[model samples]
Target: MAQTDLVPAARAPVLAAERLAVDGQYLTFSLQGEIFGLEILRVREIIGYTQPTEIPLMPAFVHGVINLRGSVVPVIDLAQRLGRGATELKARTCIVIVEVDAADSAQPMGILVDAVDSVLDIGADAIEPAPAFGSGMRAQFIRGMARREQGFIVLLEVGHVFALDELAALARGVETAEAQA
Candidate 1:
């Protein structure tokens, strides 16, 4: 029997490879009291909370830069970026380093979260379209909502959440102003 013999010809339509990639393991974490998830593959590492060197003119959510093995990496406060408010750093607070896509390359950035949660394997069937409201954050930042036993975990589209171009522009502005000072 051929592979097509398993399914009805009418129901054997294929989907794009990219579309199928959405369902996979996610690294879940908490922001405020709500749970959120990021694709595990993007995560580089998690480190203990360290005060970042504040960069003048950067946005409030941009917690400034940290030296990771001699490389300066900008840390973003996810709570404030999501409009929830600043994250009150506690014992469990840590930075989740993720590789976000830039214009022509991937840049490593840090996202500060309340605490790291467990990894979850969410299937496409368990995912739902982002709702129009009540997500707390902007709808565009959400990839989808993954239904879990506890509740729905807002799966973030990291590229949208951390737009490198916008950040780069702000950095350029700061650099220009500093040079003339």
Candidate 2:
């Protein structure tokens, strides 16, 4: 089956509150030797790392954009965005495409990770609230932390991680500064 086929049709839109409270599968991946997960429902597909077309004046974390079956989608460097330093692409590197809620719409975005791991079923009982400190990343970016026999999986809140509104505002500020200059 095609990667697109894995995506569910006619599925109910996931709400922010319900995203972390539900028990379901998570698509885990490795970044800088740490395990990170994203709600599987939000994931559309995964593809091998493809060099993206560079965009000028975008945030350093914004790697660039790619043409996805005709759609120009922005790709983010997950490690850099998390302040863990930029990811050094390897043979195992992959881009996980996900749909993030933005302004009453779902936008397709790609996140570059070190490698794609298995999809694990993480129960609600095994989840804990994001820590107030020492998570290494912004608290809002974390949906929760899940305990596994291997270790803790940092569950990411996709909407917060790829917040289009916040990014747009930041981009606007950059543009305004450039114009003033």
Candidate 3:
């Protein structure tokens, strides 16, 4: 008589992995004692504070351009642009290079920041919507606010900040004057 094969033992149950709400990451930094962040994908590189070659007739916020490996990129003072007083450059000061596309062009621009903190992995649930209150800076430039142990980091809409349409118009006017000369 052929012996019947023993029935296989039941396998242990496997639990499904819990999905986290937070997905994307942000680069957190400080400006005027307030925290701020930008999506890591938008940030190209970070460099220490350096003297920029001032461009004449440009807006105060436009700190001029710098030669980064043969590429000329404009630098904007985020503090001044947000209506905050000029920030004194400290050892921690840095320039965060951001790539922004314009309506008519696709060139990237660089923005000078006070200091960089760390890269934070924030979930969607961790981000809080910006308040409706009229903050000094335009609401359009805000992506959302992220809360951290230190405080809330104002996440910036880099695309809106570096659009440069207004500045491009002003630059066109100067170009026209030069052409007429």
Number of backbone collisions per candidate:
0, 0, 2
lDDT of 3 by residue, 1-181 (tens): 2223323332211110112233588888888888888889888899888888998766678888999999898989889877788877888999998888766666657677778999989887777666668557876577777777866778887776767786677667776777787
Q: What's the best-to-worst order under lDDT?
A: 2, 1, 3
TM-score for model 1? 0.82
Candidate 1 Cα lDDT to native:
0.86
What is the Cα-based TM-score of model 3? 0.78
Error of 1 at 39 (Å): 0.3
List, residue by residue over 59-177, the lDDT tens digit for candidate 1: 77899899999989999999998987899999999999999997788889999999999998999888777788877688768878889888799989898899998777867887788
Give the poorly placed runs of model 3, Cα more than 4 Å off. 1-22, 103-106, 170-181
Of the candidates shown, which would achieve the greatest lDDT relative to the real structure?
A: 2
- The lDDT of each candidate is 0.86, 0.88, 0.76
Q: What is the descending TM-score order?
A: 2, 1, 3
Question: For model 2, what is the error of residue 162's alpha carbon versus the real structure, in angstroms, after optimal superposition?
Answer: 0.7
Clashing pairs in 2: none
